[model samples]
Target chain A: MDIRTLCLGILALGDATGYEIKKMVAEGSFSFFSEASYGSIYPALTKLTTEGLIECRQESQSNRPDKKIYSLTEAGRAALEDSLAKDPRPDKNRSEFLASLLFAEAVAPERINSLVQDRITSHKRQIDALKLMRAEEDSPVGQFVLDYGIQVQQAAYDFLIANKGRIVTKL
Target chain B: MDIRTLCLGILALGDATGYEIKKMVAEGSFSFFSEASYGSIYPALTKLTTEGLIECRQESQSNRPDKKIYSLTEAGRAALEDSLAKDPRPDKNRSEFLASLLFAEAVAPERINSLVQDRITSHKRQIDALKLMRAEEDSPVGQFVLDYGIQVQQAAYDFLIANKGRIVTKL
Candidate 1:
C-alpha cells in the first residue's frame, strides 16, 4: 500500500506518531503484507495532513520534544474505505536472488554458493521474526499471515539445503 | 531487479528482438521474479548497446518490419556475472489487500467479502499458471521455485477460503 493509505488505515484503529506507524510496519502485526520505511512514512504524513485526509495534534512534553500525534479524519476513513472496496493491488514477490540463480550456470560456482548461503541466513531470520509475531498474535488472521510467511520461508530454506550439495558440486 | 540489470540478464541467455524480450518476460520462464515492460526494455537495450555490453543487429524480412536482435557481448557477460556475485535485492510482497484486512473492523462486511473473493480468484489463476510452467520445467531448481510459488499461493487461497466467513459476518 502507499504510505498515505497505510497511515490512514493505521489511524482507523487509534492515533499514533509517525515513528509508531513505521515501527508497526517493521516489527508489528502490520508487517505481514505491508512495508514502509521512515523515509516514506514521514513524507506521506506531511502530504496527508496537507490534503486534510489526516489531522495532527501536538502532545506537549515538559522535557523532551513534543510528540506529533495523528489520526484519520472522516474524509480519510471514507477514502480508505473506498480504496478497500476497489481491487486490491496485485502481490509482488520480486526476488533478485532467484533472478540471479536463474542463470547459475553463468556464475562462478563459489559465488552461487555464497548467494545461496546468504539467502538461507536471511530467510531463517525472517522465519524467526514470524515465529515471534505468531506467538504474540491472538487473532486468527494474524496467525494465518504469520504462518504463511513461516511456511514459505521454511520451504525455501529446506529447498536450499536439499539442493545445495548438487549446486555447489559444479564449483 | 532494475530493468537494465534484468535486460542484461535476459540477453545473457541468448539473442532476441525487443519484442521477444517482452514476450519472454510476460509468458516465458522469467515471469516468476523479474518484470520489465517494453517502455523499460527498449531503453535498457539502447543503453546497454551504447555501453558495448550488448550488440544488436537488424534482420530484414519480406513482409515484416526489420527486427533488432540483441545479444550479450563478452563485456556484458562479465557485467552480469559481477552483478550476480553481489547481494540480490530483498524480496518484496507488497499487498494492499492484506493491509486493508489488518483493519477489517473498519470496512463494510460485504466489501471485505468481495475483496477476499477477488484475492482467491487471482491466486487460483496464479496456481494454474505455475502448474503449466511446472509441467514443462526439467531443472530441479526451476521445479523448486515453481513449487514454492504454488505452495505459497495455495496456502493464501486456503486461508482466505477458510476465514472469509467470519470476516464477512461482521456486515
Candidate 2:
C-alpha cells in the first residue's frame, strides 16, 4: 500500500504525529500485516500535505522536536475510499530467513542456528502481541486481521522449531 | 527485499534474459514473495553488468528482440551471500481488503459483499496454486516456503469465508 494512503487511514482514526504513526504501525495489530519506518512515513506525510489530502498542525513539545499533528481532509477520506474500492495487490512474503536458507550450505552452522532461533523468538513475540491486541478488538476488521496474524505467526514458529535442526545441521 | 538483491538471487539459479527473468519471477514460487516489472529489470540488469556483479551474453533470436542472458559472477555470488547474511526485512502484507473492511460503514452493502466474495475466491485459487507448487518442490527451502504460503493463504481464506457476513452487513 502507498504510505500516503496508509497515513490517511491512520489519521482518520484521530490526529497523530509521524512518530505516533510509526508507533501505531509497530505496536498495533495492524503491524502484523504492515509496517512503515520514519524513512517512509515523514516523506509520505509531506507529500500528502502537498497534495492537499491531509492537514497538519504544529504543536510545541518540551525537550523534543515539535510534533506535527496530522488529520485526514475530506479529500483524503475520499481518496482512501477510492483506494479501498480498487483491487488489492497480492500480499507478499519476502523473508530474509527464507532467502538465506536457500544458500544455507555456504553459511556457518552457528549462523543458521542463530538466524533460525531469532526467527522463532520474533514469531513468538508477534503471536503474543497479536493475541493481546485481539483481546480488545471490537471491530470485525480488527478481529479478522488479528486472527490472520496469529494463525500465520503460529505456523511460522512451529515450522522454525520443527525444521531448525535440518537447516542448522546442513550449514 | 530490495529488487536488486532479488535479481541477484534469481541469477544465482541460472543464466536468463531479462524477459526470462521477469517470467521466472512471475511464474515461480517466488511469485508470492516478490515481483518486478520489465521497466525495472532491464535497467537493473544493465547496471549489474556494468558493476561486474553479473555477465551477460547476447543471443540472436528469430522474429524477436535479441536476448541478453545474465550469469552471476564470483563477486555477484559473494554480494548475494552478503545480502543474505544481513537481516532480511520482515514480510509485508499490504491488504487493501483489510483497509477497506476497516471502513465498511461507508461502502455500499452490495459492494462490500462483492469484494469479500472476490477476495475469498482469489485466495482459494492462490492456495490451490501453492499446493500444486508444493507437490513439485525438491529442496528444503522450497518445501518450507511452500508450507508457509499454504498455511498463510488457507488461514486468510478461512477467515474471509467465516467473517464475510459480519463485515459486509455493517455496510
Candidate 3:
C-alpha cells in the first residue's frame, strides 16, 4: 500500500504528528510489514489534509516548534476501510543478503561464514525486539502479528544454524 | 543491490539474452530474493554495456527479431566480486497482508478470515514452487537458498493456520 493509505490507517488508531506517524512506520506496529520515510509521510499527510480525508491542527510546545497533529476525518476512515476491504497485493521480500548468498561460489569460505553469522545475529535482534513488542501489545490483532514475526524469524534462525555448515564446507 | 550489479552476477552464472535474464529475475533462482522489471532490466543492461562491465551480442533468429545475449566480461566478474565482498543491506519485507491484519478490527470477521486464508494459500503455493526448484537444483548453494525460502514460507503458513482463530474470534 502507498504511504497515504497507511497514514490514514495510522491516524485512525489515534491522532498523531507527522513525526509520530514516521515513528510508527519505523519502530511501531507498522514496522513489521510497512515502511515510510519522513519525506513520504509529510507529503502524504499534506495531500490527505488537502483532500479533507484528514484534519491537521497546530499544537504548541514549550521548548519545541509547533507540531502539526493529524486526525482522521470521516472521509479518511471510510477511505481506509475501502482500501482494507480490497485484496492487498502479495508480499514482496527483497533480501540483499540472499542475493549475496546466490554468489557463494564467488566468495571465500570465510566470507560465507561471516555472512551467515551476521544474518543469524540480525534475526536474533529482530526476534528480541518483537518479543518486547509482544509483551507490550494488548490488542489481540497486534499480538497476533508480533507472534507471527517472531515465529518467522525464529524459523529463519534455526534454518541458518542448521544449514550454515553445508554451504561453508562446500566452499 | 542495484539491477546493474545483479545483472553482472546473473551473467557470471552463464550468458543469457536480455529476455532470459528477465525470466530468471521473474521465475528463476533470483525470483526469491530479487526483482527487476523489463523496464528496469533493459536500462540496466544498456548501462552495463556502456560501462564495459558486460558485452551484448546480437543473434539472428529466423521468423523472429534478433535477440541480444549478455555475458560478463573480466571487468564484470571483478565488479560482481567487489559487490559481493561488501556488506549487503538488511532484508526488507513489505507485506500488505500483514498490514491489512493490523486493522483487523476495522473489517468484518469474514473478511479477516478470507484474508488469512488467502495468505495461507499463497504461502503454500510458494512453498510448492520452491520444492520443485529444490528438486531440480544440483548446486549446494542453490539448494541452501531454496530450502531457506521453503522453510520461511512454511513458518508463515503454519503461523496463520494456528492464529486465524484468535483474530477471527475476537472480531
Point out the higher-scoring one by TM-score: 1 or 3. Answer: 3
Ranking by lDDT: 3, 1, 2
* Candidate 2, residue B36: lDDT: 83
lDDT (tens digit, per residue) of candidate 1 on B1-171: 778778887776668899998997887667767677899888889999999999989999999989999998999888888888678877877777777666665545456566677888998998899999999988765676677667777767776677677555564
**Clashing pairs in model 1, backbone N/Cα/C closer than 3 A:** none
Q: After superposing candidate 2, which stretches have Cα over 4 Å from the reference?
A: A37-76, A105-114, A136-140, A163-171, B105-112, B163-171
Answer with 1 or 3, whichever has the higher lDDT: 3
What candidate 1 gets wrong by more than 4 Å, as runs, is: A62-64, A161-171, B62-65, B138-140, B161-171
Q: Residues A44-120, candidate 2: write the lDDT tens digits.
A: 99999999999999999899899899988888888877777787776666666666555443433346676777778
Calculate each model's fnat, 2 decimals: 0.52, 0.42, 0.77
Per-residue lDDT value at B41 in model 2: 90
Compare the candidates by TM-score and give the number of the best one: 3
Q: DockQ, per-model, please?
A: 0.52, 0.43, 0.74
Model 2 docking category: acceptable
Q: Which stretches of candidate 3 lie over 4 Å from their true place?
A: A107-110, B107-110
Candidate 3 lDDT by residue in tens digits, B1-171? 888888887787789988998898899877988888899998989999999999988999999989999888988888888888888888888988887877646534456787888888999999999999999998888899899999999999998988788887554
lDDT accuracy of residue A125 in candidate 3: 95
